[model samples]
Target: MPRSPYMHLPPAARSRTVTAVLGPTNTGKTHLAIERMLAHKSGLIGLPLRLLAREVYGRIEERAGTDAVALITGEEKIIPKAPRYWVSTVEAMPLDLETDFVAIDEVQLAGDLDRGHVFTDRLLNLRGQSETLLLGAATVRPLLEKLLPGLNVVTRPRMSVLTYAGSKKVSRLPPRSAIVAFSADEVYGIAELIRRQRGGAAVVLGSLSPRTRNAQVELFQNGDVEHLVATDAIGMGLNLDVDHVAFAGNRKYDGYQYRQLTAAEMGQIAGRAGRHTRDGTFGVTGRVDPLDDELVEQIENHHFNSLKVLQWRNSRLDFASSASLRASLDVVPREDGLARAPIGDDINALEHLLRDSGISTMAKGPKAVELLWDVCQVPDYRKIAPANHAELLSTIYTHLMQDGAIADDWFTRQLAFADRADGDIDTLANRIAHIRTWTYVANRPDWLADPAHWQGVTRGIEDKLSDALHDRLTKRFVDRRTSVLMRRLRENAMLEAEITSSGDVLVEGQHIGNLLGFRFAPDAAAEGPDGKTVRAAAQKALATEIE
Candidate 1:
């Protein structure tokens, strides 16, 4: 038998009481982990998504107070003096931080092709001083046990029933439903249809800035929108008041290829439907075919095939030189059920930079090589192309190595390009992505000459862009007059009406038409169902006022 890669686990770490809280979504596993972390004097928790990390940070802050909690993600960092609790994205979690308790959500992601290596590394190497909790689906149980001996495993039942409601059209999905799609184009298309048919839908995509995503979610949660159009981003523990999940498309491009979602992946997203003790349903919509009976049974039962192997990468890098660094990263794992991950964005960026003779010469020593590796980790948020992203990375690396830090003027110029708030929805979203790249740069310690000042400047710009993007999305996909009237009608609330002296009729502060004597004329633009909706609402309100 081959020796284990985790043989380096210290005696203390090996002895810590590590618990695996395995369950489907809405089983309150995250809630339990948070409670456990708060019980300790100091603790750290790593979540799968920056959005989830932000959500958890807010919850922890509300309980532990702002001064005691710190939030760290690639693009955002908020650390307070003498912080007792730390919340971070899995990629951003500081493994060196010594805490009494440590918890990692979505442990099953260790099998993910792209990001699994990081999760696998955390699973094996990161341990709390006293207690550690691994929270994820029950499918991870077999793998967790094989990896960690003497692991305490607890399974929780779903709090509510998950049923298969079969297929439904986008226009027919229930209120408070979330229509899940795999691509931005699909999401936008569905949202547009819902706006035409069901008033509007809040949009949530992995690409949206956390601020914008949250604002969009608010539109649904607060009843401004009757439905939500989102990608599988909602799968990563976003607690929403959703009663059903309609899959507009099941297949997704998982970094490498467009493939059907595994039963586990489907369960994760479908599981987002119900919250707490409320029941939920899942089904197909749009152009996708209906799920097979067996697959539907598996999802409804929350049963999934156990992960056979986990993606692993050599975290202990040589960094002596670029060549040594690449060699070390390619090292195979000795442990069973562990496979080397394919080249990721960071490694690709490194290879691209190494191709440049100037960069190769500068990245000579261990310090320089390590800095190069760190620079490679900057994510390609813009997604323009690999070459374009590599060019940006090269510029940043050259600036960092030539000067002690990136030149303020150059950084400011890059930021200035994305600072403008004028753009259509796609344009604004693109600008938000551009600003996010600079935000990540600003968050990197020592990357900028004045990290604190740049952090503030970049964050302000991101917030501004996020707000602009949100407004653009709402304007493009939402009809506020229709949504307000429909919601009011649903609630059986009496509508307010006013008539101007010039005979203009208004309902709920929205101009419906002109009242000429006994005739109520709707606006020329109101046609189809919209015209009927306006007439119905107008008649209800005017009956009380005109009489």
Candidate 2:
């Protein structure tokens, strides 16, 4: 029978319930998914990253109307009640809800080490027989097809290789080009160079918060800044239209440690060029360096390792009782050089850390015990949770006090370490002082009588729980081992410097994508003791570039 015009399904999806759309960067995979979604009456769009999820939510709301869209992520939720259109991180999606259509963004990440399993399970486990659209990079298509043979597959590559009108051997970038570096320190250095080389154009880096990053993106979007110095964080969301992207650093640190980029990573950065049709000229420029050569080789060779499994468990909210996992944690292994020391064979104090920290909310009973044994024996174990803030701090303090790992006298010598370690009198102190104000208000019976105070108390507990989470997840609550591991992962990649069509030089590297957008203003000059402007001319010279 001929389908009725009132039918809500896309013509392609009408026959089959599942559809997979795959492509590399710049192939408009996401745009296609959005179009398909528009054809349906209602749908759910799931993104991997919080930033991308938020960006998609904003874009969807702008097009579909505010009442139609809502956003949810691990840290934030904008949806007060159920809305027809939902945008959320895949992990944050409610398991109970039923929707007509589901769009899974970045479906390629299903092969990722940390959260690929989430995608796999979610795709495999979706209960509702709704039409599904899977969007991801080209490399991910085969994997998805293999996993779900019932789905239809569509593949697209980059329309054309980018080219530029400028000379090939150009030493410097042009006025309106951007140089992308991988690290915060290098980004700042490159910004300084832009000031020195390009008549002091203000450069924007990627380390700034989302609000600040958006502001920086506007400067580039509005043509307020001619050149931007930034990191990979700028690559995905802002969509700054630019003529060229130059690699500042050639390498980047992966989550666990520094590593060279594979073909997929390099393509992502290079693909950022010429996103807008108006900027027809597009190019990727990189300097020759050991790191750069390695990245090139990886891309050319298409060398990449199979995805590794990353096991992460929530110690706070997942399990009902913390006391259950305590006994098992008591017999785990300690120290780095130890071999497969089984809990049944060798007993160590380190194994007891989870128990001592009051975080027994792990895998239930026997499985929890089994996992603990594996964690102790396995060399790659990275612990994620341990309990409440007080338990965590108290455990660390107790251990440190007994072992004297951190010198006690250092706390007394405040002036010596004040520069290295932020002092009580610094910005954190001001924040802490506000607690006293709240305490005084709480002491008043009249203030306590108000319902607002009760809510405030609830908020305080949530804040404490959040802080506990931050400390544990960030390795702040744990010892130096976890912190060192995190640092190693962060420093894996390096940056390579290159020149763009605009006669501007930039640093670039693997994993560091194009500057989607940027915004920054030149610092204004300050007055000197003699009443003469100190660095006033420098500031004015810098601001002039923006104008």
Candidate 3:
């Protein structure tokens, strides 16, 4: 009997008991899952985001001891030789390992246009020997009932109050505010506005590394910073002390197209403003038009569109070859009137790679498809333009297949070229992306003879690029008018500048400060103006030069 590619159950998955745990934000859905996972002798959790995966991994380790849990994401992996509990991003989840329990967080993303296929696949395939928990928004109930007959459905509620606060400007935002935007530029723009008016803001976005996001989140959580500017990525279980969420824009560009967020999405994002034990308010800002009254009311009232069909894609291993798989992908969307896998970017890149007649003609059978898919699965760490990224991937794929190993000099030359920073924000992002790609490649113990050395070197480059990007973002987004050198402006040959009796301080014809009421240099406090102080010898240097 041929099974629906969408529902091709792994043989063992049939023996598991499945429970669909449904809820909105602040609900105890994940909390319950964690409790169950801890209670079970061994367990695995699949999270939609790397950040969320790390969060759960840490919590599990704290309770189960670090060795009991393993963390795996596409770009990073930390695991014991025999991990008792595997915490991983959905695609990275170790399905081959059996555990007493399994849970998939944000299961409703199964209908997500691009990333949903993996979720649906996980929902259909991965199962624990004893228990399997599928966690997500309640909107998925119908789909679950239809797709998984006999599945148990459990619902949970918001632990705190969530309401629609009338839309307003950034300046009027409250403390503990989170300004959500769709694009990096918009996130930065709103964050900068908040910094100017409200001190500095913690910036969070999808492209940031897990470590970077954690540090940024810590800044907001510690009360050192009052506001956070982020993308919709925060909606998926990334908790914070947010009392308000103001949307800088209501629309977003999904990988394929720009579209209005669904009622479900709007509600998910708004729900983040409030948490257990605290009421939260949400609204629109940064010149974005307010959500239509009905949509606003829907989100406020928790009314959302129901899920009908699960979004899915063929993982049909029977495809004769990589070429055949691409052909099927091209035809299936049109044949079925369904969207091609939301996750087709990588495969699309692979197609471009195979465009060379030599590569295209040499491929046939499932083995070829598997090899191509493996190459496609490589992360686009460089985040270059899709075509350019695909071109590079194609080149690398060709080299790896033909040459077995990437040339050391070829890879090093790219890094050497990336050593310079561009002033333009987009260019800096590109450089960071390239370093990230290098870092990713460098981490593969199988790919490099000395993975540790290359990993360290690549990390140094990534860190340099990341720091440069943060510095650029901070300077552009923050209001630092109280001091001159604090702009981190280029240094001058002058020993140091003095504060004028009028309080106008400058060195070498540059205006520096009207001290923000700090005794002594307060150089660290004044120049570094981060909620954290950046110490400088400004005060001591100036005093010494004068004496």
Candidate 4:
């Protein structure tokens, strides 16, 4: 059998020291990292997206065997007793591990203003003897090499082009084939088009949950999906095989208006094609805008291939204070400020005024609002905030009540109400009615007390449910023959039938179901148009076997 592509890597690349796998897209860097883990016996893989992490876990299991792999993303954890291969999001990864290797799949995230520091710190200082591999798009490849001088650099120039359909004047796609757009509206628009024109490809947004994103990938891979309408969330380690990648939109959210894609971004996404063996058709397609021919030319020329150093700085609202827009500005020079009066009300406002006074360089316009949400969720946000923090606290509290633990939601709501009489009215007014409705359905005495397994319904509702309902439901379910059979199946309980040496038993096999009188409905699926019923098939199979 042929060796896997991941199996053969140079010793220099797999040493017990930091190693960098910097390159353009589709260079198979992630696979290389996995191979290093396999050879070294243990390692942790960090991916930016949960879907990618989950997929990595599945692949590792397929290669290493069940229970040999573990997944630790935000959504779920399959922690093996002695897991040798762990897959997780960068943030979810344990701060310290005794493993032989740590690989950050999309290391260029070091340029992100929000979570970039985590990856940068990891690249700069990881304590174990284990090796580290930083994989990312080509634009930031030089930055990693500069930061880590001992790092090994590998560059795989993209071999594919992005192609698309539309008139030249339509510069940005309405959302067709992986179009790059800045706003949520553009993504939705593109998604709608794919749904109508190309048989409905999955819409990929940065904020979508891991489970939902994986479902989309599955649909695409299984041929049920046509296009993948996505944001930059798919730019990194996602493995979506496509014959043609079209930039449906040009404007990327750079803090203000949706602007055109930088050469680096165009190159980053184009690299996704011709991945593994590289014998496929991959190209870039986009609408041409006469106003921005220079950008188009740069994209076509691949001038963005040269490594450019970028700092992680972006504008953001100062949720710390009462004033919103003034949060992320700069201060004016002493000489200029001395001649003028105090600029703005708060620090944020002053900072913005300083920008007007030519005090600071204009950074990327805080392109990602999702980053703020994640940061706010951090337990330390309170420690970072200034006074008058109620409104910010309220916003964070609302989000938690919706997405966090149910108990936490109830506790926070109660705490909010206790804090102030107005707090209760404000909190209740802003809250979605569905959350309360769901709470009611989830917590009703009859529902809770019912004998349903309940685990699938919600994990934390068990204690809150009425004991009486639980007992009643349990008894009813346990008494059912079907439920009993399912339990037996789950337990892998074997059925032992006794027989005489002459083949005449205490009871003949021919009348087995008659004794039990239970139908083994093998075809207990939906009714089909062929006129054959699943229950009938099950009955026939049971009858044939027994007779």
Candidate 5:
């Protein structure tokens, strides 16, 4: 193995108080971290997902005031002058900024394949001046102790129990349940089935913009929908009032290959079922096989194998040239239980750029090579193909090297194509992803000539597309009449009934059926259980008016 690039660096002093709070999901580790952070005069917290960052940012802003809080993510930046608290995604954290307190959420992601290296780098290097907190699953406890000898470790017990409930059909699943699938297609299929049989389901996927996702989640939270269909994105720190979690698909493609979820992975998702002191359950749905007895037991008990290693990559890159940078990345870790991560999208894009003779020629000196590496770090949000993504980076790097910034006309053209709000769910989702790429570019300070102006433009387009997508989803999967009637029925409240001049009977402003000559007829579209629900609600509400 090659000598470690960091071996030559002098040892640095440790933080005053570096604490690792380890536990399973719903253990309130993240909440505790935030409380500790807010207690300090100045602090920073790095979350694993943009959604989580935004959530925490809002929480912090509520206490610290928006003027005292700053949010920094790859695609979104909200910085007030001299902000005292910084909430950012782990990868976007300003490690160089010193604060009295700092915290990193989901620290166990250091074992992840695609982005583990980033988490590991932050774990090893980033530190607060007076106190530092590392929050994640209990699986990382041993690794934390081994890696940082003097580090303090605290284990938190789950606030509520998680039990396995066995298998059920999608239609038979209970209310306030989240059905988990591994892919977008599976999530949509499950959601559609739930919508037909159980009123409707709110959809959640990793691809959704924050605005769109929050809207969908609101539907479920507000009781407009009884179920939520989502990918593994919910396994993160998304707090939902889910009483049960049903796995629609047990297998997922983990960047490299398709495989069954590990026991710990299942626990992370299943654990999201209940919040606070409320117990929750997990089980299989659809054609998925029931989890084995031992696996089920382990998940319920929050017992699983601890992580043995963390993915590592050299962050101290030698930007003198592309070759040197690559070489630095290949340097082996000097510590035990640290393995080099496989080539990620950034590396793949860099390799593609290096193969291009013209691009390689232009990427010569330290500054140019560093810039090339920076451009390569742009995420492949549109997962069309690796070469296509690399081609985009090439255009960006070439423009920066030649003209100092991306041309406004060219950038505007890209944004214009994705600006339209008209499209189906899939089309609108794709447009959101496309616009997200430009949004990420706009956030880069030096990439655009007018970063602030372009950022606002991209954000506005994304919000419009997100709203359109939300509307499309709601129209397709949600039966408005059914959801409204069901919610009112459950509340045991009198429904608002109205009959139009044309003899159309509407319950809560949702057309239920037509009334003619003292006889009521349900709409043709209202059939099955939903139709029955509407009929029952209409009769109860219109009894006095009809009499």
Candidate 6:
């Protein structure tokens, strides 16, 4: 079989030491990896998240001059023109960039349903120039032993002890606690409650930009906030000064449906509480069910399931034509020595593209089809309909064929739309997502004559939009008091006229109902297809201030 290109590296790479550092969370696994990378002249570390990449990049740059380290992710690259070390998300790592030391964080993700194949590919392929280190859960040890014979493995015990203390009320959550929730809305709701009771709380979620996330975490770490409410994004490798872990809800929506968290996942999140040598405790809150006695005992005792097989996907499909690619994807149900991973959006989108006669017809030959197929692999962060994404790509292919460049006019217009920052939360999010697509396009430097300029413009715009969006999220979600007051002010604005006997406000001769908060029961005549009119009470409060 023609395997990954890296497998055929020279004897020097084969002679390098490969260490599998196995352990649970808070085991100093990542710290050990960092130390190894620093000991070498040049290094590359594969992080699981863009936020984590930024964190590591900053740390490495601080220690090893800014020009010595490069950071690369899907939509952003802070790669120094000449870098001695690389910090990158797993998918974005420059495979050809040789290094003295190479480390993969959260190596157990090699079995992840969505990204396991990428992780497994890295595991099977990466031959660092000097040394290679794999850091993650103990479950991966058995598979590593089977796959990489004679590989050295070391299991580290958690620096601090984790004890399951049963369930607790949200009101009873200890100080310096980190509460985990599944959704942004839930995280915000919990943070809002924490603000009311504990004065304030830090908030973190996957959608947040790295700068925003770092600032939010600093609030809790720097003692400005006693509590932190966040999503499972924390389960990866976010370090803070948290003393307790509280589950706002046991069940989390796994991009498919709401389901119970697995033992491994629970252990990972709970492990965040006790960092270093300090003993930590965890429990449930927000009416979530208590952990079963057996599970709780296993958690307190540090027992977790064993890994059986690693999940893998064939991203290295050798095909030049769309039809050949589709056929390969359809027929190759499994690969030798690797288990098939869950169906990803890329495969689904590729199928849709193949079926669409218009898009499929554009790729007249293998070379063209291969290029189009590469474009299809770029994940759509917008989460737009598959058909819409297909149409967008089809148009791009046409434009590329015509000018050998992306339709700069189209991207410019998108920037204008993204620049409109004064909008609701969903509007801002959509605009931000739109700008991200442009950023991804800009990632392909060859696709533009002035690629550097295009990238610089998009980056600045993205930063502005991200800052605006972060401000909105912080005010609407974290600063609950400000949000509530703003709502009150809006309601006050709409109640320009004194509360009429009928409880309707005569604003510009329109009978708008008096909004108690944002919504109100309208009088029979005030009802309309669009729902009741909102009394801008907050604006009224602002007018009083002006008076």
What's the true lDDT of residue 512 in model 4?
21
Best by TM-score: 1
Worst 10 residues of 6 by lDDT: 526-535
- List, residue by residue over 1-547, the lDDT tens digit for candidate 2: 4222222232233435677776545667767767777677777778776667777888888898887888766435556354777888887666556667787777656655456545655554442245777776666654555445556887765543444333221227764566667775666566655443332233444323233345555545655445666676655534566666666665787555787655566556555665634332323444423234454444333343433321222111222233444443333323121122223211232344345433334334554444333233211111223323223233333423344332323322321221221322122222222232232223222222352443355335334433332222223111222112222333442323332344232222111112222332111221121111112222222233334
Candidate 2: segments with Cα more than 4 A from true spot: 1-16, 80-82, 164-171, 199-207, 276-353, 357-547
Question: Candidate 6 on 258-294: residue-level lDDT in tens?
Answer: 8998888888888888778888989989578888888
What digit string (tens of lDDT, one per residue) describes model 3 on residues 33-135?
Answer: 9999988988989999988898988899999887788987765667777778889999887656768888999988888877888888788777777888999
Model 6: what TM-score?
0.82
Q: Which stretches of candidate 4 lie over 4 Å from their true place?
A: 1-16, 127-130, 157-180, 197-199, 254-258, 277-547
Top-down TM-score ranking:
1, 5, 6, 3, 2, 4
Candidate 6 regions with alpha-carbon error over 4 angstroms: 1-5, 8-16, 330-337, 477-547
Question: Per-prediction count of colliding residue pairs?
Answer: 0, 37, 4, 24, 0, 15
Clashing pairs in 1: none
Task: In model 6, state the lDDT of residue 425.
Answer: 60
Candidate 1: TM-score?
Answer: 0.97
- Candidate 1 weakest ten by summed lDDT: 2-11
> Would you give me the overall lDDT of model 4?
0.47
Backbone clashes (count) for model 3: 4
What is each predicted model's overall lDDT from 0 to 1?
A: 0.90, 0.46, 0.73, 0.47, 0.90, 0.74
